[model samples]
Target chain A: MPRWVRHRYASLVVLAVVIALLPLLFPSSYYYRVAALVWVSALAAIGLNILMGKAGQVSLGHAGFFGIGAYAVAIGPTHLGVPPLASLLIGAVLSAALAYLVGRPILRLKGHYLAIATLGLGVLVALVITTEIRWTGGPDGMPVKKLVVFGWRASGADTWYWITAGMLLIGTWLALNLDDTPTGRAFRALHDSEIAARVAGVHVDRFKLQAFVIAAVYASLAGSALALMNGFVNPDQAGFLHSVEMVTMVVLGGLGSVIGSIVGAAVLIMLPQALTVFQEYEHLLLGFLIIVSMIFMRDGIVPMLAKLPGRRA
Target chain B: MSKQSHFKTLFAAAAIALPASMMSFAGTASAQQTVKIGSVLSVTGPASFLGEPEDKTLRMYVDKINAAGGVAGKKLELVIYDDGGDANKARTFATRLVEDDKVVAMVGGSTTGTTMAMIPVFEEAQVPFISLAGAIEVVDPVRKYVFKTPHTDKMACEKIFENLKQRKFTKIAMISGTDGFGASMRAQCVKVAPTYDVQIVAEETYGPRDSDMTAQLTKIKAVPGIQAVVNPGFGQGPAIVTRNYAQLGMSSTPLYQSHGVASKSFIELAGPAAEGVRLPAAALLVGDKLPDNDPQKKVVLDYKKTFEATANQPVSTFGGHAYDGLNILVEAMQRANGADPKKVRDEIEKTKGFVGTGGIVNMSPTDHLGLDLSAFRMLEVKGGDWALLPPGT
Candidate 1:
């Protein structure tokens, strides 16, 4: 193997080892619960980075797919009698198919128009989930069945921590691998200039659609994992606010970096928990921190850090 | 390149400075010396209207109790988290309270979805959770560690149906929001209407944020044999429904609201349309108007006085739930004689005839809420405020 290839994967290997050793640091199940939430959100953020950072496509309504993924697990077990694990797979497939259908036409739009189109898609999904009270449980939400493998039912924050962390590692690995492939180059080409990419025979339309679908699947899997972990699912999981939150996580984490995704998820999730100590001033302080970070770190935390005096390539 | 390095240096300084700032705010609690009680409320966001008062009530009551010598001779420590009405955040805070804070009990959940989300957490940890939200499903299956203070939607339905029977209004029209609270109340009302010999002539539903329900109300008004209109929901939907009902000049058709809108804000929002409106509410709303012989009078008055003085706001029914929850937990602690979670769980289940701002609660192994239909007082908006209707009138 080439030394360049080996060096390129060194950080991913370090991340895997770090995740494997994190259980020893957990003070209680509470830490594990929060760790799982961070991992689940990171998984979604990493996939989103591929679309937003690599392909330069912005989706303000990806929570629509996330909500679909959650409802798949929630409704599948109770209504279809499918096991939780199978339902997760069902959710991923459905999300991918929906993304393909939705992305084909909507992906043709550029810049803010694409964002608005995705936003509409998300709002429509939330409305359907809210109005279909009989099956979706309306706004109050429905209980999700625990994921059981053989006879062992999945419970506890520790169990979810390991499961979500493993899934996140796999998701990051795939995204990193995609970044080095021909399709990844095609995505970058289109991102820089779509007309130039089309003239260069890069299949601009197909690669953009591929990125959208892949991101949708990643969000779906994360959503399914979250619903199973919490034992609940609601329409808000697919609402516009959640979509905005996912986008914020990707941008805040340094756009295209897998490690940045993890850092972004950790900062946002833990910042709120840490701010609880502030009591009445929690929201005010949180808003201040977000604004300050965005103003200073224009390219995101990781990308900016990589440009350090001693670290520049 | 210099700017990039400058940001790197700045962020490095920020990374070091951030933890130091957090450390200044952090203080270790003496966990063994105090009986720690944790609570999760939607103190901000859309549900802040419900959570703000609940948070104030708990703080006021906890201070009052500790000032009076504390529960079981141990100083009480209250740890509260704002969930912002999100279930995922509620679950996280509930776990943090149980595992990190090591709270022996919990006492607040301002929304039914949030309370239900935390049920498995409390049940798994074996900590007694006294929920302030009103959802029968929270305690219907009877988890050993979960209890609630507010009356259930089923109870509210029965109260409304019984009132309809008293008025000889056999035919009725219903309009509800499509939200969780509205959906649950609509289900319960439909389930109980037949038992009271009342037929629902027209059934219509509106979205949660719909500013006008005239289209739906107009459809109901067109239905023949409709004697009354019932709107079961919280927030602006019911208020809008009231305005639309009056605007259509259906003044002869009595309008009924569910207990979800039992608040001064509802009256204010609905304007003059709220006059002559009827609903079932906790006795706390009409505390001053209650007869001297009423059992809940003293408890309601005391809660209203202390909570108003501390919170600097008028008492709300949502706040009354928090007051009842804390008081019930304190009473259970006195009976159990310790802060052990298992003992508190057992003692809370044995609670009976405890007069609260909501009503007199009677608990059994099967009933966690410990309140029956009697907990709801039939209230009418006589002028601009809630007025208790005379019994059997």
Candidate 2:
């Protein structure tokens, strides 16, 4: 068996085992809800990792795609009479198309200029969602219709837990497999050096756009999952702060590592919950904790641990 | 050597460590004799101004209730989660409150967004939830388990219009913020204006963060016979608008603000420009000034004194909303003789003439928020302080 295939099978098995076993320790359904959130957030971070980690491109506007998916599920069922599942698919397609259109021009810019352009895109999406109060419910947001799969109604934390966990596994598997793909190799080549990749005839721009499009689909799917699970959608889902959060998760989880992205999502999502015990000092303590973690493991938790002397790659 | 083994070990360790750490903090087992009350508030983020006071108020009141020999003869146990103004986090905390803590009653949603997010969780769990948010949508359709203490934006508009009617002023211009609270209040005012014999001849909007509303005010000033200019916004925007209105020398036309700026900070922020500015607010702001004959006088004064003494800060109407929410829930729990969620919900629904910091609440089957226009007190900023206006004008 190929080494990459074995690696993919191993990661999937471990993730599946963790998902299957975590419930044994969950004292109540609330943990399931929280875990579901971690999974959904991780899925988005993994999508972002493809752009940031694999392609060495930064996107601060990923949440705009997330908002599209969330609103699609919300507006589709309520106004368009489309099924929630179908709306999720439609959102992904829409996000991919938008990413392609927008990435063509903005992705050409590098570093801070590209960052600023993406930031503007995110702010614009948030403004539209907030101003279109008639459809989007303004800043107060609107309730999403319950996702119904055939005869089964997707409600409850436990149901969403299984669904989101399954989705995360698939997302991780796809990301892991992409590591060895021709497009994935091209992304890595461009990430190493754009000029070098161009000299090697890697079609740098096309690969960057492809990574952006794939990342958008991932974010859109994650957003739909979250909206469905929460039974609500709001403009904050697409806000600039959320985009910053996605980038933070990717960077903190070990940039290009699939497992690292998931780990980063888990830490960021769960740390706040854990730190709620600090009462009014919650934010202060959270900041302190993040600073401490970064000081100890600068390359992110998973990557730093995996690089331990005894662990052979 | 396969890299898979190393990855597998790391994954297993992480997965176990994360849940294990969370489980350690899963709340220690308590005796069943305690009545659990859960709350999810935006205590640490942008809306912390509302939630901080609310959190302080709940902790103070719960301690007071427990010291007063507890509600329904069972100790009151409070479980609170600060959602940091994130609606998604608020929803998760709501689930934890309902499922993990198994709270019979819940209070606290400092903002409209947080309240709206948690409404479904409480409704699905059949837990009695009294919100402190200022949105009308919270109790409009009357969800069985949902109630609110704060006056809705619609009531604010109505009270202002009623004041306008008393003054016999029909022509008005509106400069509203384009944010959620401002936009919704503006819409409510527009919807209810004709019924009050008021016409909004000129209308303009300012962004939430805009420092100067001079341009909008200028446009409103251009309109002929603009009797009064109403600014329906909260935060620093209203204060800036007040300053801009003063700077523009539009004092001849009376200025009105919504209940969103019913805090001492608004008066402080607007400074001398706030003079003669009128807005609808709760009785809590004018607790010391209320006549002896008023029904809410004693309740309002007592809450003010206790909250001020304990919190070490002047009381805010936002805190008063939490005060009202808790008292309503406790009173319902006392009447039901226990903390059974269904009984408490029904009792809360049947609450009548319960004097609170906000006003005299009279809930019913159809009306979740039973306070009428009478509950709102029209106050004018006089000499850099709130001065209660008489019922008519």
TM-score of every prediction relative to native? 0.96, 0.97
State in Å the error of residue A276, model 1.
0.9
Best by TM-score: 2
Residues B1-393, candidate 1: write the lDDT tens digits: 233433443343234224323433444445687899999999998899899999998988898899999998998999999999998899999999898888999999888889878888998899999998877888889889999999999999899889999989899999988888898889888988999999998899998888888899889989988988888899989999999889999978999998999989999999999889999999999999989999999999988998888778989999999988998999999999989899998999999999998889999999998898888999999788888988774
- Looking at chain B only, the TM-scores across the models are 0.93, 0.95
The residue-level lDDT of candidate 2 at B122 comes to 93
Q: lDDT tens digits, residues B1-393, model 2?
A: 246545543553365346444664657586698999999988877788899999999999999999999998999999999988899989999998888888888999998899999999999999999999998999988899899999999999999999899999999999999887898888889999999999999999988888888998988888899899888988889999999899999988999998999898998898899999999999889988989999899998898899889889999999999989999999999999999999999999999989998888999999998899889998999998999997666
All candidates' lDDT scores? 0.87, 0.89
* Steric collisions counted per model: 0, 0
Docking class of 2: acceptable
Q: Which residue pairs in candidate 1 collide?
A: none
Can you tell me which runs of candidate 2 are displaced by over 4 Å? A1-6, A309-313, B1-17, B20-25
Candidate No. with top DockQ: 2
How would you encode candidate 2's per-residue C-alpha lDDT over A1-313 as one tens digit per residue? 3455345567667778788988888878888998899899999999999999999999999899999999999999998999999999999999999999999999999999999998888888889999888888988999999999887999999999999999998998899889778998999999999999999999988999999999999999999999999999988899999998999888887888888888888888887877777776778887887888889989877777766744553
